[model samples]
Target: MIVRPRPNWFRMLLVVRGSVLPAILPQLLITLAFALLVTLLHGRVFVWKVSLTFVPFSLIGLTLAIFLGFRNNTSYARYWEARVLWGEVLNDTRSLARQALTLVDGPAPSRIFVHQLIAFVHALRHQLRGTDPAADLDTWLSDEARQRLQGARYKPSAILLMAGEWLRERRRQGELAAPLVQAMEVHMGHLSDALGGCERIAGTPIPFTYAVIIHRTVYLYCLLLPFGLVDSIGSMTPLIVTFIAYTFFALEALSSEIEEPFGTEPNDLPLDAMCEGIQATLLELLGERDLPAAPKPVNYVLS
Candidate 1:
């Protein structure tokens, strides 16, 4: 995601990062050109009085705006829910690390738990983004663990299962006491819930019917607008149509970008940086040196 300070008004007008202007530029230009042609035709083409009034357009515009607002809100809710789920990931991982460090009797076993926790973060990030996690997981997991994860359908859940099994093994070996094992199990459940939540969001999306209806409505409104404005706005029809088209089209584009919330879009969540942060925190808890550096934003964008 773009991670810069807010720009001043003048600079903000020209800012492109995290903005949908680029994606909608073609649509805006086309609408402007159409409006220009309509204006030159003087609301008539080839002896045809092709004209429309502003009244119906105005009423439709109001309802269209409301629908756009609703769609945007729905998209933002998905985005925010994704953020919240990742927040839970960070919290639960930290909590698990703390429990393992304090309750587990041996540093060797505790370090294994920490490595698994860190690997789980990377695994979840890779799973959500649909990227290969072999490189990320190889360093933290043993050859056997890594091989077992290879070709696994749900790698993050597979990693979490390993972690839980490790905890159960330790408990059986009398390394972790019953009460503290129970505590760790609770945190493990939180991790499981977070994984399930992210998967649910990634799999499910805003209804297709709503998306189709809103998409057609926005395009129809933008295309029909020039007909309504050319006779009334006269020479200024192009500018007005382009501005309105930009507003409507940009919103639609942004909603589509954020609705998924896991892709590598400029506005999508920074899963890489988040996973790195989790790794750093968990490794520090395990007193490991030579920790990987936290991810830094490039060109004011983090991912």
Candidate 2:
């Protein structure tokens, strides 16, 4: 997220701030310490004597390493894909809002529909964050809309359906003709797909058992890596082990963090900011005052 690279190492280090060590830092510390101790005592004091021929442990560890690499790679792909899909959703939501305001015929319900569209954005942010929208939805929602959402199991979807029903009613009253109404339906469908896509990503996560397996394998690999290298590497085992552990651990940590890129985390997708952008665009069409302002991230971090 650090754009415009600073030449100074100190500045760059500060830029990377809390991206440093994770909760698994303790494991890294243990791995490095064990590696140094074994390497120092490798030939001088003892040998683990684990090998593919004499001991089967070495081959097992090697196989685990290959599995670790592949697991991390696949998880990273999922993480990246989730972000990309959300980005598309963000764009499409803006487009839907624009169409809803401009194309829909106006007055009471249509004007209310424009506001509800904005409320839906925040509702979606709440849905993604797994929180109630009661705190923030007041600005965009009317009393009737809020009352409808009171016990709704899925608030965002409910709000969306309201928009659809409103559209149908308008068409019924001859407020919108077939072509314009059909065009509005298409945009509404796009919003529906976007909502469904995000819901799918949230509802169906990577299998828990596979995650547990990958975590256990990474731990086992680090544990055995020291023993394998210590006999040959000597005192320098600490540095080598740390470097290797850092690379693997970093990848694992990154994949996990980004897998659900819709939170308060530094790299979380800019859903709130994106929603505000949609609000602004739609408000321009409604010519509404008290418009929502974009939430600019502090130090390039948007939550």
Candidate 3:
């Protein structure tokens, strides 16, 4: 995601990296051409005068803008929810690590649990984005655990299961007290909830019907706008139509980009930076000296 400070008004006008304008440029150009043609012909082609008045366009435009606003709101809600889930992941993982380090006596089991927690975070991130987690998992998990996760349908859940079993083993050996075990279990439950929330957001999307209806309405409205304006706006039809079309088309494209926030789009959540932050924090809790440097935004993008 783009994480720069807010730009001044003059700079904002020229900002382009994270905007949806690039994706909708072709549509803008086409709208301009169509509006120009309609203006030149006085909304007449061959023997037909397809000229229209502003009344219908005005009514349709108002309704279409409302629908677009609702759609954008729904998409933004999903984006914000996904971000909140990741934040929960970070908090729960840190809590788990702190509990294990303070309550558990055996350093080996505590270290193992922290490693598995890190693996869980990495696995969840890669799984949501549909990328292979083998490389990251191998760094922390054993050959047996790694091989086991390779065949599991959901690697994050599998890793969490390993963590649970590890805690159970320590409890059986009288290393972990019963009360601490229950406490750690609570944190583990939080981890499971975070995982489930992320899966829900990644798997289910805003309904396709809403997307289709908004898409067709925006295009139809933009295309017919020139016919309505050419008669009254005269030579300025292209300029006027193109400007309005940009607003509608850009909103449509922006909603589509952010609807699936797990993907690697510029507007998507910064999962890489987030995962790195989690890793650094957990390793620091373990008193590791070779901690990784913090992640920084590149060209205003934090991916």
- Separate clash counts for every candidate: 0, 0, 0
Candidate 3: the clashing residue pairs are none
Which lDDT tens digits does candidate 1 get at residues 1-303? 988999999999999876888898888888888888888987777898866899998899899899989999999999999999999999999999998888888888888878988899998988898888889888999999988987799988998999999989998999898888888889899889989999999999999999899899888888777888887778998899889888889888988999999999889999989988988988888887888777888988899
- For candidate 2, lDDT tens digit of each residue in 161-265? 888888788789887777887877776777777778778777776678977887787776666666666655557768877877776677677667666766667
lDDT of candidates 1 onward, in order: 0.89, 0.70, 0.91
- Residue 278's C-alpha lDDT in candidate 1? 89
RMSD of each: 1.2, 3.6, 1.1
Candidate 2: segments with Cα more than 4 A from true spot: 1-15, 18-23, 43-70, 107-109, 288-293
Whole-structure CA lDDT of model 2: 0.70
Which residue pairs collide in model 1, if any? Answer: none
lDDT string, candidate 3, 1-303, tens digits: 988999899999998988988899999999899888889889987889995998998999999999999889889999999989899899999999998998888677799889999999999999999999988998999888987876798999999999999999989999999988998899899889989988998999989998999999999999999889888878999999999999999989989999999999899999999998999999999989798788888988999
How many backbone collisions does model 3 have? Answer: 0
**Which regions of candidate 3 fall more than 4 Å away from where they truly are?**
none
Total clashing pairs in model 1: 0
Candidate 1's TM-score reads 0.97
